[model samples]
Target: MIIGIPQSRAFKWSYRAYVTLFFIYLALPLATVCAFAFNDSVFPSLPWEGFTWDWFFGTEAPYIGVFHESPILRSLVTSGVVAFWVSVLAVFVGTCNAFLFVRHEFRGKAILYVLMLLPLIIPGIILGISILVFSSSVANFLEDATGLWFDGLRPGLILVVLGQFSFITTFATLVISARLQKFDPSLEEAALNLGATHWGAVREVTLPFLYPAMAAAGVVAVLMSFENFNTTLMLVGSDAPLTITMYDRLKLGSTPVLNAVSLLLIVVSALLGLVSLLLQKRKD
Candidate 1:
């Protein structure tokens, strides 16, 4: 009995130790990055340089903060705009697709559904290339056939939006459709038997129930759009997104400024997560 008790205690201690080490492994790099953001050194790597707020809050020329860095700030604004529009468009299209796939059955439905989901499995790089090539071909064909110029066909914000939407909308559709499938068809039938029209029944009954799923899907869409790099790299033009801008800076030669940007993003992401958790808890 004494041996068994000791063995159990040893197992518990070992489990806790493993968990602690795992967390430390995950957090060490992030902690290092945050620490170096405030380091007085120009480079992000450190030899224990004295602390300074130059990276985050410097008011002077070379030591400009993230908010004061015009190029980074512009890139951030571009990212925000792209993410916002992507989320809105993805949600609208994906919700419609969910309804189409889940609520109705038609000929070639299986093939169409497979085609829609194909984007999810395709590599981002390949998908980006395909989109660019197809767009260019279509643009050329239209010019040759109709002789009418489609000015928005070039590699720019429109192309980026379309490229990101290809996969993001698929993700949203899967989320909303999963929730939609769980809904009972009898509710709609009951509403129809009463005085409700089809649109009215959908708006009044199914939509309210689907709100939570749609909200979650929208959040996912926005986050994915904001962080997407591979597809955006191909589609972005002179006006670059945050990820592309960061990549360019890294290639040129990284500075503590990158660390500062990382820190701000980490804090903002944490706050967003906390707010989302609180909202979910309140809803529960």
Candidate 2:
């Protein structure tokens, strides 16, 4: 009994230590980035010369310049546009697909589901290259067959949105479908029996319930779009997305300015989340 007691105690202690280390691995880098955002140095992550917001706003530091002057600002705008389109397109298409998948008893539905989810399992770099090659081919074929214009058959906005929409729509579908599955059929039947049209029933009763799920799914889709790097690199045009821009900078060197960018992203995302939650609560 004494020997077993020590062994069990050691196991428990070791498990606790492991959990602590795991959280540290996850959190330390984020903490470091957040701290360095406030650093006044030209380098994003350097020994603090003094506290400053020159990176966030602007300053007269030797190597450092204004925040707006940073290439990151342009990249940020590009990222915003991509994320917006991806989220909106994904939600619209995914909602319809999810409704069909949940409400209709169609043949080959399982196969369709598998195909929809295939991109989620595939590696992103492979997906990016595949998209580039496929879009280029399609663009050439269309141009040859019919005189129609397409974005420069390679890296460009059209390809970026298309590639992202392919997989991200699947994510949105899963989200809305999960919510749809919980719906009671009796509610729809009652509406129909009470002389409501099918469209009216869906508009008044079904859509309200799905609103929360749709919003959450959209947020997820946007976050995924914004953070995507491997895929963005292959698809984004000369106007680089933020992730690509950051990679280019890192090739040159990391900086406290990079941390400043990270900080801005974290803060902005958090603020948006908080605002969304507050509005949701107010609605409730």
Q: Taking the candidates one at a time, how many backbone clashes does each contain?
A: 0, 6
Tens-digit per-residue lDDT, 187-254, candidate 1: 99899999899999999999987787777777777778878999998888889999899999999887
C-alpha lDDT of candidate 1 relative to the true structure: 0.86
TM-score for all predictions? 0.87, 0.87
Give every collision pair in model 2.
43-256, 44-255, 44-256, 44-257, 45-255, 45-256
Candidate 2 regions with alpha-carbon error over 4 angstroms: 1-9, 61-66, 146-148, 270-284
For residue 258, give model 1's deviation from the true position in Å.
1.3
Report the lDDT of model 1 for residue 117: 93
CA lDDT scores, all candidates in order: 0.86, 0.81
